[model samples]
Target: MRKEVPLLITILTAFIVILAFFLTPLAQTQQILLRWYAIIGGFAMFVGVWNLLKKHVFQVSRGKNTFYSLVLVLGFFMTFAFGIYSIVKYKDAFYINSPFMFNFNYVLAPLQSTMFSLLAFFMASAAFRAFRIRRLEAALLLFAASIVMLGRVPAGYALWHKLPLIAEWIMKIPSMAVQRGIGIGITLGAVGMSLRIILGIERPYLR
Candidate 1:
């Protein structure tokens, strides 16, 4: 009965939202339900934090990857403490940008940039291997990529006047068409999946 009730509510809510889009009479109801959704989502965030705290604390206590677990736990608690301190100091519940923001900007931002820089090098190495002229498709892709890269720079215009135009044509025609086709496919797939969930044929939420 518990499972059945949740499934029924899910289906009913899905239909109500969909109908509200097309029927003006249910618009207010949809807005109220959306507020309920936001409230539930806010509560879910605390549940997630609780779970993360438990996992990290357990790891630290058991001495399994103790250093990493301790670091993670300290980072989490420090951030939380700073956030609370900021709110109280400013007397604004939603106010951001304090010691916490400084830590994020100075400490985390550079680390993230470094990680992304390393990722770019790895991606370039991968592209070099894949772009080798081993097959017809690979050859064409390499040619197109080279043109786009070169044409976006000043050197391509100095080297060849027509290179930029060709790059633009390739991007605007072939690239745009492929993107549109992929977007349509994704939209159709999402619609099918949503319908399955709304009909209660797919119960992924139960798992």
Candidate 2:
């Protein structure tokens, strides 16, 4: 009964959302449903956090990589504590230079930037291997990538007068067209997936 109820709600909600596009009354109902969805989503985030904490706490209790697990748990609590303090101390309008903001700027931002900076080396290595002129397409891709990379720098202008102009043309024309084409393809794929879900062919929610 529990599973069936959720499946029924999923199917019903999907149909209503679809109908909302064509029906005025349903559209108004859809707006209300959207607000409810937002509320549910906000609550779900807390549930997710609880689950994460429980999993990490279990790992620590089991003495499996206790240090890492403990760090994770501690980080989560510290962040949460700072967040609550910021909100309370500022009355929902946290100051830009608050303790929480400082932690985010000095700690979180650097960690995220450092992670991406480390990936740059791996990306360059991969690109070097992939950009090898093993075929016509590979050669073209390599040429385009090199031009784009050089165009982004002042050194490229110093090296050659027309290189940056050629790079700009390639980016505004071929790159933009390819990006738009991929976007359209993704939109079509999403629509098809939605239709399949509405028609019950894809019962992921039921699972």
Candidate 3:
């Protein structure tokens, strides 16, 4: 009975949601359902927060990487507290002007940027290692890659005037064709999946 009841509710909810999207007269009903979804999602966040705190606290208590765990907990609590304080105390100012934004801009932003900047260096190193003029295909691939990279950069245009033109042709023709083909394939696959779900053939929610 428990299983059957939940299955019935799920089917009914899916039917109502589909109807809400297609049937224009049920706009008010759709709004009500959306409000219910929002309320449920808000309550679910409390569960998420509890789970996160429990995991970090357990790690710290076990003394396994306790220092990092403590840092994680401190960061989480500090952000939460600052958010609450900003909302409750300074109702007029934007949250971006709060302590959260200050920490994010001065500390987190620079750290994140630095981490991602390392990826460019890694890519250059990997390209240098992988690129070899041993075979015709490998030589062609390396040449094309180098041309594309050079065409995009200022130094490439300064060194050779024809590079930008060749790069533009490659990007506009071959690259666009490949992109369109992939997009069409993805669209068809999504349509097939949606049809399967709508026809009750794909029952991922069922255990």
Candidate 4:
């Protein structure tokens, strides 16, 4: 009975959402569902914070990577406190020069940039492995990657007048075709998963 109730709710919600796309009458119901979604999302965030606190606190107590866990716990609380203070002071969490925004701009953004900068070395390593001239496909990939990299620079144009034109053609034609194919595949997978949930064949929440 517990599983049946949630399954029925899922099916009904899916129906209303699909109907709202084509029927004007159910659009308001869809908007109501979206509001419920936001409310549920707020509750989910609170649950996640609680779980994070529990996990990190246990890890800190058990002396398992205690330093990192302590750092995470302290960072979360500091960020939360900054957010609360900013909201109380200016009624806006991200007002310019607020402590929260300061942390975001200085601490978060730099960390994010550093993380992506580190990824460049890993990506270069992977590309080197993938671009090795072993098969026809790998040779073609190496050729395309070389052309695209060179085309973006002024020296390539100085060396060969047609470099930029060929690079643009490869990007617009073959690259775009592959992108579209992958996108279609992703969309179809999403649709299939949605249908499975609506039909009660996959009960993820119950698990």
Cα displacement (angstroms), candidate 3, residue 133, comes to: 11
Each candidate structure's TM-score, on Cα atoms with residue i matched to residue i, is 0.88, 0.82, 0.77, 0.90
TM-score of 3: 0.77
- Model 3, 18-42: lDDT tens digits are 7878998876777888899899999
Q: Judge candidate 3 against the unseen true structure and give its global Cα lDDT, from 0 to 1.
A: 0.82
**RMSD score of candidate 3 (Å):** 3.4
Number of the top-ranking candidate, with TM-score as the measure? 4
Judged by lDDT, which candidate is best? 4
In model 3, the worst 10-residue window by lDDT is 86-95
Q: Candidate 4: where are CA atoms >4 Å away?
A: 87-91, 204-207
RMSD of 2: 2.7
The residue ranges of model 1 lying beyond 4 angstroms of the native Cα positions read 92-97
What do the candidate models score in CA lDDT, each in turn?
A: 0.90, 0.88, 0.82, 0.94
**Cα lDDT for residue 96, model 1?**
52
lDDT of 4 by residue, 76-154 (tens): 9999999999999989999997999998999999999999899889989999999875999999899999999998799
Going through the candidates in the order shown, the clash numbers are 0, 0, 0, 0
Report the error of model 2 at residue 84, Å. 4.2
TM-score of the candidate numbered 1?
0.88
